[model samples]
Target: MDEINSSKQVSVRDFTTNAVQVLDPGQDVMQWTFGGLSRDSGHFRDADLAKILRNVTAAPASAFKACRTPEVLRIIEILSIEQGQKWGVCTLNEFCKFICLKPYATFWDWNEDEEIAAAAKALYHDIDNLELHVGLQAEQAKTLWPGTGLCLGFTISRAILSDAVALTRGDHFLTVDYTHMQLLSILS
Candidate 1:
């Protein structure tokens, strides 16, 4: 941190001591790092999973850079305390609600139990379908998006954990406890 402060090129707009927000202070916090796990890992926005599936999985690593953009920054910013309060995050519940109402929705249209049950059967086989898969249960999904706070449904951290579990069950996944947003991406 002192080195960061000393660097002429470094921005001094903010500083921290032990993650407690000593400079430009607001919340009490600490930092954590997830690294050096055996299994492969990558960080991504919910919106960017499609891009990753298309580019990184389907094409090549060189094709990956095209999908990284400010839009991702904006979406992730919704999870940070600094910006989340100002620009509310998109709730998965709200997104689902929109799906139920929107005439252009590519997924299930009806809200009734029978229709939802039928849709569930269809989605069960193709669980990777983004339009249908939100990792939260019904009650949790209804929880108001804690704007300027963490997403009420599945968090980015949990998503990473889920990815690790999916790839190699019981494999260790590292993550930090701090609420301040951080980015972790695996290029490969």
Candidate 2:
């Protein structure tokens, strides 16, 4: 921290101690790192850190081009409606569409007894095809974090948002979730 303060080459944000505490609960040691301080310290007074945060927070809509195909949009609409109703939202038609849709579409026969059963089969087929095309992206990821290996199966689907955020270099990777934040800090 003293070296960073002395060099003064990179603009640093000053996060309040309170904010830092809130953002990093278990891994408070991260506050000592340059990136962590910039995010947790109430020091947005620094021009450079402010600019970095702004760039990070902006949505990457262009990346969603692949997610908006007609088939994906339809599925997203269905999922969004179901999710919206559960959340007590009045009009989730549009928002649900956005959340459920993806750039890639996988087709499957829907003759199964249950809609979920049919959807799972379709999703499995799509994943198998995707695995062939991408050559085990999760396997590649295991090389990066070898200790526990890459999360797979059901957990992989739940991690889509985090995976997307991880791809963004400009994002502030801060959070109270120690495990995720720790991984982000290392990856960043």
Candidate 3:
């Protein structure tokens, strides 16, 4: 575990400077595009991703390794693609249309999250009228990115780290995109 921990502390580029060829010829380069794109985007800094992986594994309750590997990188690439696709369709117009089909509260469930309800009430001061609360929530939802998929980041993070294994070579980072004020996860 100590050796594993030490590797994560090292600069990612130090290791990556020596590129390891993918052993499998049929390993579908297209699937690896997200990984390459993420690396090229400058958004997912390798060192940063290494740090995040370290942080996650450092948690006392964590059941994951801090090592990065090709398999891990592949998983991260897929996750990035999923996030990009979700964001591509996460337009305000789409949110408005979605709200019309279903009340925003159904997905958000203000009552379920006391903080959400309190914040809504604080802004509107109309807890008595359900319609007003719903409307206020809808407006708030519009201001959020991925208006429909609010908890996507948490979900994806859990999925990515659920397996109890050490990190390996191609492993990358998954991060929350807070700019949209929505719970979105993206490949870093």
Candidate 4:
């Protein structure tokens, strides 16, 4: 906050130079990310803030080796999962069935990683017990086909597409020009 208030506007060239200097993979790119830079004594540096911005926007997508999320965050995540379950959120298998896809028989079906599957099994006990949102985040991004650009979780992608079609079909505003008959064919 201090940095934002005190900083002067910088030219595009200066911004680009700073970004290039930090984004060099040979350097410790991970140190510039949100979790790494100092927040000690309840303060942070302007250069650290700038580095974080570059890391978020310009860093390579494949650079992440691990989540590196703090242990405290895992406790918060557990609370979130409990709250979602309490609110009657469906399990991942249920959601898959609802979407006309086959329900996953095991955690292995959800993801190939043995460690992730083991963790899910320890927490949820079975595939049917896995929470929807947790599975959405944990599942590997499916390569739908050649040339399909976006790398998204399979269930998340399906849910978004389902919601989009439902919105188009149910909303009177979106159907103003296209006939409901034609909309069916197009959305279908």
Candidate 5:
């Protein structure tokens, strides 16, 4: 932290710490790295998972410039917080409601694990203010059923499932590119 702070570069960590209004000055709050899909969760108005992480992931290692893995992860978390602050994007419950799923009623509902829920509560103060990325990642992953593909957190699975359904239902391959067998072959 001191090294990054000493350099001329703007400290994104400091920005995030301030932007999110860290609930505890003594505790380090990287709110989005909750062991779920945080690495994949920066999707919002000005920031996206790929846009936010591609450069960091592609950065030169032991070369001209490099970022620590934790630093990169923190940047993703920071982007989510900044996006929420700028755009007033929906919180986790609101997002679930938008997507036709039940909103998590409490922090415990968000993550069954006692410790994780406690940590999230400490940082966010309430479920109503929980950032989309943070709450989405904090949710405990649902058990994968037989023959089902994803083992994602409950919210992530539902969000992804809805998106995938929309994409497949509106696919150009089944509409714009539709074709029939040649006339000669059909006759034969």
Candidate 6:
């Protein structure tokens, strides 16, 4: 884990230098999650992270009526059948009803209407061909060039370590039993 952090510390510096070059060319890059280095640094403030999560949750729900993905629906149906077999009652409806129990059930709580609408528009613009790539490249940039305070720096640094497996596409996700060199197989 320590070694991965050290490597990421180095990679972030390199990535940031490259990002500056790309942005300098007037490219259309989404810098919203760049930890505010590109714009209002207050957006990346600690209080904002929680608000961001809340907004994300509400935006999807308001824009899509429901967050029912096919995979999630299937999981709910299977769980319903299993629970019905044991309790002789359809727990599926109860589970579905419980969706409102979430904190973002009301969109007003997050003030996310505009953000969600904007995100939906952006997503649909490129929806014809979905990109399989993860957003780790941007995440890497955030960890490297975060414009937040020392507290955020330490938080993002630790996050970089925790998500090292995801960021590097390592063979194993984060396992204390493994050495850093073995995990670098993904990089190779």
Candidates' C-alpha lDDT: 0.35, 0.38, 0.40, 0.71, 0.66, 0.37
Q: Tell me how many clashing residue pairs each candidate has.
A: 2, 13, 12, 0, 0, 0
Tens digits of per-residue lDDT for model 3, 1-188: 22434543444443344334443456765445433335454356677678777987785442211121334344343444456556654432233344443333332343435565566567546433333213322333212355553322222233335433325323433223333334333333
Regions more than 4 Å wrong, model 4: 1-76, 144-149, 178-188
User: Regarding TM-score, does 2 or 6 come out ahead?
Assistant: 2
Which model scores highest in TM-score?
5
| Model 2, C-alpha of 124: deviation from truth (Å) | 17
Report the C-alpha lDDT of model 5 over 57-151, residue by residue, as the tens digit. 78543211112224445566566678877998789888988988888888888877788888888888988878886676657766657986445
Candidate 3 Cα errors over 4 Å, as ranges: 1-52, 60-96, 99-101, 105-108, 124-188
Per-residue error for 127 in candidate 4, Å, reads: 0.9
- Runs in model 5 deviating more than 4 A are 1-10, 13-71, 144-150, 176-188
Ranking of models by lDDT? 4, 5, 3, 2, 6, 1
Better of 1 and 2 by TM-score: 2
Q: Which residue pairs does candidate 6 place in steric collision?
A: none
RMSD of each: 22.3, 21.6, 20.7, 14.5, 13.8, 22.2
Best by lDDT: 4
Runs of candidate 1 with Cα error greater than 4 angstroms are 3-81, 101-188
Which has the better lDDT: candidate 4, or candidate 6? 4
Q: Name model 6 segments beyond 4 Å from true.
A: 1-49, 61-70, 90-188
lDDT of 1 by residue, 27-134 (tens): 322322223222224343444556545665573322111122244233232234334335654443344444442221222322223544355447543322322222
Q: lDDT (0-100) at residue 96 of candidate 4?
A: 93
TM-score of each: 0.17, 0.20, 0.20, 0.53, 0.55, 0.18
Q: In model 2, which regions exceed 4 Å deviation?
A: 1-34, 38-42, 54-85, 91-188
